[model samples]
Target: MGLDTPRPRAAARHPARSSPPRRSLHGLSGPPPAHERTPLIRSCHMTHRSRRQRMHPTNTPSRRADSPIESLWPHRYSGVMISIVIADDHGIVREGLKRLLEVEPEFEVCGEAKNGREVLDAVERSRPDIVVLDITMPHLGGLETLERLRNEYGDTKVILLSVHNDPTFIQSAIGLRADGYVLKDGRAEEIVTAIREVMKGGSYFSPAVAKKIVEQARSPKSKSSDPFTLLSAREREVLRLIADGLSAKEVATELSISTKTVEAHRTSLMRKLDVRKATELVRYALRHGLIEP
Candidate 1:
């Protein structure tokens, strides 16, 4: 035991103690003072704040002031609304067309008319970009209205809407420089597409109408047998009115013509159509689409 004492005081006996229980920051009364905080904790707070700032930046990009037109109508004419006037003899037809056209953001229906006479008034008042006109309106026919518009408002585009796909009607519209021809029986989208095409400085026709036009172009004699083509515009107007059961005096008043002139037109119509009686004239007008049956 003598030299063993030098061997180490038998390594002093000590009680085995478990590791101290871990303490969470949340469980603490408060965070340690800033200087007492560990570099790792401070670094974590700074990193979290930096990440939040990066995710939700305060600044936003600015929009250009001169891009309103580009933003509104990126695919169409810059900044311009395509103004339109719809003319149809039937109120329901006009209402339907208005409702259909109003859906397009770029289209604006500026005016409406029930007949060709009102069409002129609407065009004068609104100065619209396009006119969708019906062919067989009362008082003034569509072809006559188109001619007047071509003369008065040369810049305004005209699209003819007709139920007839006859070559005579198509040729007449083409001759009058109609920008488009859309049949009433066509799909509703056809009219919308026609307006867009006409606005683009191009022409559009229903497939049937286009085919009729091509047929007429190929055969000039196709319309010769149709006696309706032999009638003058004034004579046609007289026939339509006469067929509607208007007397010579009423026709004169409606047309602002003398009764004698109306009688003369009646005679011309009868001679051209080879009809002797007023009843026959009505039948012919009905058969030839001069008046609504």
Candidate 2:
């Protein structure tokens, strides 16, 4: 009778139904599929490559073992070498200067010339940063060559190398805007210092030359009364050739001028120098240091 409401049929026993398996955001997976992992692998590889590049830059230069200065001051030189051209009438002198200059790691002697004409040729060919020019050379003198260089190649720096420490020579160099003047008799180091100074947008003069310049500056009478200053560059060239014993035709050939033009220059030189005969011209040239005596 307690058959009761039949005990509600003992609440029919129904097995609990299991909930559906949970799923991650990627998918129902422990490890993602190959396609899903591809982006992550690429990102990791890119990060590692960037870190390697940061550790070792491509443009870094290896240390130079040859030059202590270069190694000590790596940022000073900018890795560019200075080009130089040396011109002298003497083979021995040119060789000596070449050896002296090549000692510097930054200096490269691009070419060598035995005289003023060759100096011009070398400059045209090489376009060097500097020209070390001897004052006296056959066919064309250093001063004339410097004039041509100043007109044609304004960027090229000129340094006069000369045996003459005369104030006249110094004055002429200054007037022509020469970058430096170093006496040949001075120490070989003087030329080296001159090149360095000139490259720095400064000028250099040998101690003796400097002293002469100062002396001349102080002396009002040193205004260069020497008739040599009166002659034009062409006249000077003609005078030098005549004094060197070249005939008028030979002088014409050397100068690439007609015989009549050579004669005209000769005449002009004589008038400016107040001379009469060819012998007088030779004497004047010798006295003025135009030709080697």
Candidate 3:
């Protein structure tokens, strides 16, 4: 055999190794398939976002977030017009309210009332969803109307439109569970916003009124402003329970007394407090710390 040229050893067989696929912003040679990609993409994105935020600190968010009230009143999705009854003692005021509300397509002026009596009648006849009430109406006031509405027409909501910004008035309306409170001097838009907010099952107060409430909460209380000094401890307890929205029978049950006794205490407290109605008593209780608003 011609000295066989030593056969060259076959190159050692080896598996081909592939390089990692490169990411392409222009999608020419696109990123690796999902399963083959590294898991750090999300982490890289988050890191970039954190650096951007640190470079530009913003006081207000770029987009306004949804308010707590936005979750309420699913009926809003149904697109039903919110019916409203405007109740003010002054004809001029009622006319202005009617004019203001008429412009909003979402609202319907179901009725107008001069006083609390007419308000009741209007509510019975029209069955409006909301009542924009004046605090100082004759015969029955806003708080009284609110109380009766709570007792009789549980579905109807009330918003107190008033000139008064006193803490006692604010506390009273809140205690009676008025859905909204707006100052007469505030912009007309405020009333509209209040209506929307209240219908959303949220309370709204004028900015000034809210500020006053905050300041009062931070300030020291004076003995002279303490309404509790006018009543005995027993009377105070009864008022407290009543202000808590307990009926006479309920109060009696809670206090371990007869309903008659509860009624007597209520009457006595009303007279001593110079209040004519249960709503007024509740407001007094709220203002004096006999009960919470």
State candidate 2's TM-score: 0.72
The C-alpha TM-scores of every prediction are: 0.72, 0.72, 0.53
* Ranking of candidates on lDDT, top first: 1, 2, 3
Which residue pairs in candidate 2 have backbone atoms (N, alpha carbon, C) closer than 3 angstroms, thus clashing?
A: none
Query: Which 10 consecutive positions of candidate 3 have the poorest summed lDDT?
Result: 37-46
Task: Provide the lowest-lDDT 10-residue window in model 1.
Answer: 37-46
Residue-by-residue lDDT tens digits, candidate 2, 1-293: 56555544565478788776554432332654443332111121123345345334565544344565555544343323567899998999999999999887668888899888898888887777789999889868888888899999898899999988767677888878899999988888889889989987899999898888888879857655776655666777788899999999999999889999998888888888888999999998887788988
lDDT of model 3, residue 259: 96
For this target, which candidate reaches the highest TM-score against the unseen true structure? 2
Q: Is candidate 2 or candidate 3 better by TM-score?
A: 2
For residues 259-280, could you state the per-residue lDDT of candidate 1 as single tens digits? 9999988988888889899999
Residue 216 in candidate 2, Cα distance off native in Å: 2.2
Candidate 3, 62: how far from true, in Å?
26
